[model samples]
Target: MAAQRMRDRWKTTLADSPYGVRTIEAIRPVLDQWVDRRHGLLTYRLVQLLSGHGSFGHYLHKVARRETSPSCHECGDADDTAQHTLEVCNRWNAQRHTLVATIGGDFSLPSVVANMLSGEESWEAVVFFCEEVISHKEAAERAREDTVDANPLRCRRRGRRRTQFAARLIP
Candidate 1:
């Protein structure tokens, strides 16, 4: 019950975000209740993460500002938004292809993920996709950290890797 209320508050908060009102309304109904199911606990967790509410780069960039740009460091193109992570990022092309085969026909990420999770059918595939994304992203972030650690002088020369600013939240 507390989780559901938190999710609800999240929806309300998102409704006021830039261009989020309509999308949040559409996704609101499918928010998971996190009850026990036959499948593993991990799938449900991944589902929650991908539901545009998790700590993905999109969430961090927009809601937290830990990222310098909301644009994906992976593809270095489109904004590092939730839809982009699930649908557009080139780094996840193979995983996205596999998920398309499983989920079929261009379903909205939030709705389909929520349903598949609650039903526990094909939920594993969704989990696999999310896992692959996390693995690849972590690897890339680590590579970046290594480069910065090795060449701190070079990084500092270009005025790169500045400390991130915190985003403001309403009381």
Candidate 2:
């Protein structure tokens, strides 16, 4: 079937390719095309954490130039990456404790994926942690952005670049 072929192609591509869902790949190294049995779609905050492309200071400061430093704004830890936020960040201790109580053991990407796949309650717990932590971070980021007058030229250039890139893809 076409779906099977696509799944096979995805598995092959993921095996060799360096990019594309590296976070999921890291946890589930031997990637299998699993069925989505869950009802709800992945949330924005959850996707951001999964993709490592959200309001994390490391990404904002280094990649987007939005923040002043890579250190965590809440805890002052170096490199406020998704992994750091999920696993070790003191800021999310209570939430982390709740997650740990639900899932047990050290919180890692693999564990998250495993627990999420195991049952609905586990999935909800992970989603709750992601929603709480990421929403707070996003709120902080918005507050910070509000205080600063972002450069209009920078925004225009970014839009222009996206348009130019899209144009290149078109015939």
Candidate 3:
């Protein structure tokens, strides 16, 4: 059937890509579930961050060579990473507290992310946390720009500005 063929193609694509089959299986609900459409953009970004398509300083240093240091700017001890942001950053303590309070109690990481991405109950909270992360990073970038730039940097919220360090992906 045509539907079966399409499914096979999608499966093959997921298997060949970075997330692979197992991860595709785990996060598939994030694709099909419709309860969180209001937070779609942020949810998509979160999914990208979780699935290795989004930016993180450690990943940038290790794989992309976009950043000079893997160490976190906020804490200055561990690598600036998704796992660190999600579970362990002291700088994000208040944001994480909000997330925990929204979700109610400690749950396993996978379950929490899954519910955030796919379930109706936690979408708004996840979006808020993600927005906080992005704003926090942007604020840090503005400070860095201020210290380094002879002319004060103007904060722009337009389309993404590509840098020389950005790697081109054919796909």
Q: Specify the highest-TM-score model's number.
A: 2
TM-score of 1: 0.58
Best by lDDT: 2
TM-score of each: 0.58, 0.78, 0.64
Tell me the tens digit of each residue's lDDT in model 1 across 73-156: 878764776677777777788888888777764646556545555555567777777777776665665565468444342132
Clashes of 1: 1
Q: Relative to the true structure, how large is the alpha-carbon lDDT of every model?
A: 0.61, 0.76, 0.61
Tens digits of per-residue lDDT, candidate 2, 82-116, equal 98899988999999999998888666677677777
Q: Report lDDT (Cα) of residue 29, candidate 1.
A: 57
Query: Whole-model lDDT, candidate 1?
Result: 0.61
lDDT of 3 at 18: 67
Candidate 2 stretches greater than 4 Å from native = 26-33, 148-171
Give the range of the ten consecutive residues with the poorest summed lDDT in model 3: 150-159
Q: Candidates 1 and 3: which is better by TM-score?
A: 3
Measured by TM-score, how close is model 3 to the native structure? 0.64
